[model samples]
Target: MNTTRKLLVLASMTSLVTGCTSLPPDAGFDEVSVNVEQRIANKVHWYTGGEEDAQVRQSIHDRLAQPLTADSAVQIALLNNYNLQAAYADLGISQADLVQAGLLKNPVLEMTRLKPRNGEDASLDIELRFEFLDILLIPLRKKVATQQFAAAKQRVTATVLDHAALVRKAFYEAQTSQHMEDMFREVTSSTEAALEAARRLRKIGNITAGTFDRFQLSHDETRLSLAQSEMSNRASREKLNQLMGLWGEQTQWLIEGGLKPIPFKPIDVNDIEKRAIANSLDLAILKHDIEALAERSGIENVKSIIDDLEAGYAWDRESSGEWSDGPTIELRIPIFDFGHARRARVAAELKQLQDSYYARAIEIRSSARALSDRLQSSRAMVEHYIDNILPLNRRIKDNELLNYNAMQIDVFKLLRAHEKQVASRQLFVQALRDYWLARADLETLLSGRANTVSDMRGPAISMGGGNEGGH
Candidate 1:
């Protein structure tokens, strides 16, 4: 081919590669949002320091204007949580990288001037060189970068859903703590009234000093329990506030409902595990990582043999005013560093990803099964407390009251029966809390990294009759 024809062909090829590698206007944000919405079914914002800031602020204000429900709390977090916003920012960074990968490196420009010793005319040389090999690798790099961007989207979506799940669990915990605190307050009030009655009886010689002492001790214990419950309520509220990204006045928001018994529903354990493996963001990211690494390995294999190549056109005018134009080429001789280390590193990385994929799959399956069992067991326990235990305790308290009215039981006995009934109700509350917490854990297991379950288990309440040895 003629020199002009070769130059024209090279120019056309470069233009073709550049044109094929351009990014879209939105840089894939819309698609990321769509994927997030599909998983969370909630609105997500990618703040760009634009007009959307006002919109997100307004949305947060509107959601927080009412008592915070679980869904509303999640929405607020998605709009306001700093961590989730940071994850969204990663999407922008990945897209920028994708764009950068598609872009061609600017050609190197050099100019030289020389003057001959024999009073000859000055001559100049100019050379423009491009990494033509990089042009050849443009499509491959772009493909790897595109996969990276895709993984970024998945990561952002997973983070949003994870935050949503966290908000849910925190909301449930705060509500449970608040309800338990209120229950303890009621128990304390009942104990105080009983203690006052016992004091009057003891002063009138109708009850023994020991009986009054028992009432006093129970009242003090109830007060202590109430204080602890109050502390727990405060801590749980603060945690929920933090998860919702609330501060100052926003932290004072109310929860709409307390923990309640979850209705029993059988879940298909196998289906859950299947979905977890298929939809897990960790697994997805790893899969993308493997793909990117495979592409990188391909590049590395090429580099292992021929490290570098550069080719372009150069023009020169000699001291005699003789002009020359021709193609130029440069190559890096691979004599010492042969890229074996790079190939081994990539091989190790690929193996690690493959193992991680399987490991994550196994973890998801185990967690799914465990969570399903826990949910079922917790639901059953809550129902047992609500249906069988609380009513029986109430009946025992009613019978003790009747016995007191008929002069068959002492005031101490009646008071102790009431306390037992209250204790049973507290147990019922704890069961409800456990059910809700387990439900939240199940969500976390499915959604990838949300709020974790508390390690503390509820105190086991025996189902026997009321205390009969009261003084």
Candidate 2:
């Protein structure tokens, strides 16, 4: 065959091979979304620039217009958070790599002119070269790329779920801060009333100067606590706003309710470790990494045997109009470096990935167990505060008020009782916050991400006792 016909045939074969192995248009996004939906009960959208549907943004805006619930907060974050959107873009990058792997490298064209010393016309020689070895290795390369893309999809999905969990935690935290701020304001009002009564009684010589000073100190302390709680409230609200991808007017959104109550029945923790192992996305990604490495090791073994091979067609035309055409071959002699180092490196990577997979599995199980225990403990504490401690403190406050009304105790004593009651209620709010935060952590574990439990500590509740001795 002529050199031109031979090159054309080679190009045809290359096209056929690439066409057979090309990935689907969606590139596994639908599959990844299905898995994420099963775990989070929320679907994810990949925004391709202007291609994002208007309805999605509209839905988010409508949800924001209403008082935000925890589930709605998660939905808005999944749909609109810029960080999660960036994570989705990473999937596109991996898809591009996968597509590039399946494609054949472009043919190289070279031309040379030779002029004789006799001053005759110059002869032109032309060559077209194709890296046929890459064609031979395309299948293996595509397999590795496919696995890597799958791992990328899992990583992106895990990130989305992680963000959703964060939004939930922030939502509850913001709600808790709002409730605390309101509680502290009430306490402040009560302190002001007690201080006013003490001043009046002292002005008329009915109460000691020491007692009036105690009431003034308590009022000052209550005001300081109220200010701190207000700051905390604002900070928590801003954090939630950021998580929800809100700014400007969006920050004015309201929460539907305070921190949710603990469930009546404790969650079943049986075989949680086993379940976590089965569902862990991080472990799945590591397994894919190992698979890709194994495929790479195979390719390296092929290269170790024969390093480089190129085949093409060459043509030459002389001054007299004579033409020549023939096949050309280029090979690299493996004298010193025969891909041995590459093979060894791939082997080391495979081992590392395998070990990492096993280590991650162990970590997931351990984390599942620890988080399960914490969830149970947190639930018990929340229930204890709600069912016993808070009601008892309220009863104590009621009895103190009755005693004071009957002139059995001074105003300072009654105010102290109220302050203790508020302190107990504040503790109860903190326990509720802890319960919700633990629940968020548990969800993250169950969704196959290795997120550590957030710190459950909150602002301290002053007992208002330092100045009580002045009475």
Candidate 3:
């Protein structure tokens, strides 16, 4: 192209791009704004209150971390998180769309007048018309919008539940870190005592330098392990706070301990199955999607079809084109544009809905099966660690303590037993964490109520039933 033409073309392109103005970030979802107030209101609860007292902060933290029969973290997330707030706005936008879809198009108005040149007066012509689709398609459009809003609500519920599950997982992880730290500290203390006893024994020519060096190494390693555990705990806390929507340096929380033991109760699988099938957010969302697809199918039925039902009144004016007394009507037929495309679209939508429904069913089944298997395995592991390994290690530690007090064995044996006990306790904690995590996963997968691994007490309970003996 010539330089001038090229310049003109470039300018034209620029104008076209600029003239096609970008919508505001929220322009598309304005209806969501209206629903925000109600969703936000739904989150109000006593548990949503903010912490104030410095001394009681740790206790408050413990309470929040305390395991409940049902997960409250989801409720907290809905009440607190900024991202969820945005989701509420989305719901409002969808609601507004439904309202808009129900409305009809405004009729167009036109007026024309002519003036006589030589001797007479002026006359006027008027006409009014509107798109027929506005009258015919608005009800179908409204149905689609309503379905969309319902789907949005389902999504919001699902998001909150997911957040709650995450909070529980993070809480358990941080607690595990704390437990590991405590175990390492106990190990370090015992090792330190052993090292001191070894030094005295070396002075008396009872123990060798090599043994003392080994004790020193164990002590140092314990310290290193403790430090690493602390770092992990801090990171876990940060993750939990992030999910809770606390930002910046203020995100710090006072996590006291791992989950407190709760009374164990084996959930009735049948009840869970029923509840999940009825209340599961994913299922509800899928159902809403199916409804939406059905609505679209109806619209699709009209898509390839074009109907021309145009009507206009022409006034027969008097001399000089003044207002007329009567009117004449005209109609246009839909000739080339038939409803074939619309029929195809409807067929496609029906197939899409069918496919989605089957896919969702498969997903639900797979998720439930995986979760059940994991929960069973984890519960068995926890039982083995707590019932068999933990008590055996504790007895060994007690025996070693007795030997040391009697001067039958040196402090080194005592330290070794202490380390063993700490290791066993750490393993037990891990088992418990796994059990709880598995339960949480299973609950989410089945859309069932969150089953607590611990009650209000800070000890592990047998999953089968409470033993009639003391711990």
Q: Which candidate has the highest lDDT of all?
A: 2
lDDT string for model 2 (297-351, tens) is 7778877877678888888989766888888999888899988787777777677
Give every collision pair in model 1.
none
lDDT of 2: 0.79
Model 3 TM-score (2 dp): 0.73
* Candidate 3 lDDT over residue span 1-471, tens digit each: 143454355445434422332224443233322333233222311122345334333433444555422234444444456676565565556665555565544444566777778767766665554455444666677677677777775565555555667777877787787778777778778878877877788889887888778878877888888888888878876777677666664354455556655337654455444555565555566567667667766765554453433333444355644445333344444577566765665566557666765665555565666667777777788778767898889888898899899999966777788788878888788878888788767766555222321111111111111112111
- What TM-score against the true fold does each predicted structure earn? 0.87, 0.91, 0.73
For model 3, give the 10-residue run with minimal summed lDDT: 456-465
Q: Which regions of candidate 1 deviate over 4 angstroms?
A: 1-16, 20-25, 49-56, 116-119, 206-211, 267-270, 447-471
The C-alpha stretches of model 3 lying farther than 4 A from their native spots are: 1-75, 111-125, 197-212, 247-252, 271-275, 307-319, 324-339, 446-471
Of the two candidates 1 and 2, the one with more favorable TM-score, higher being better, is: 2
Count of clashing residue pairs in every prediction: 0, 0, 17
Please state the error at residue 201 of candidate 2 in Å.
Answer: 1.3
Q: How big is the RMSD of model 2?
A: 12.0
What is the full ranking by TM-score, best candidate first?
2, 1, 3
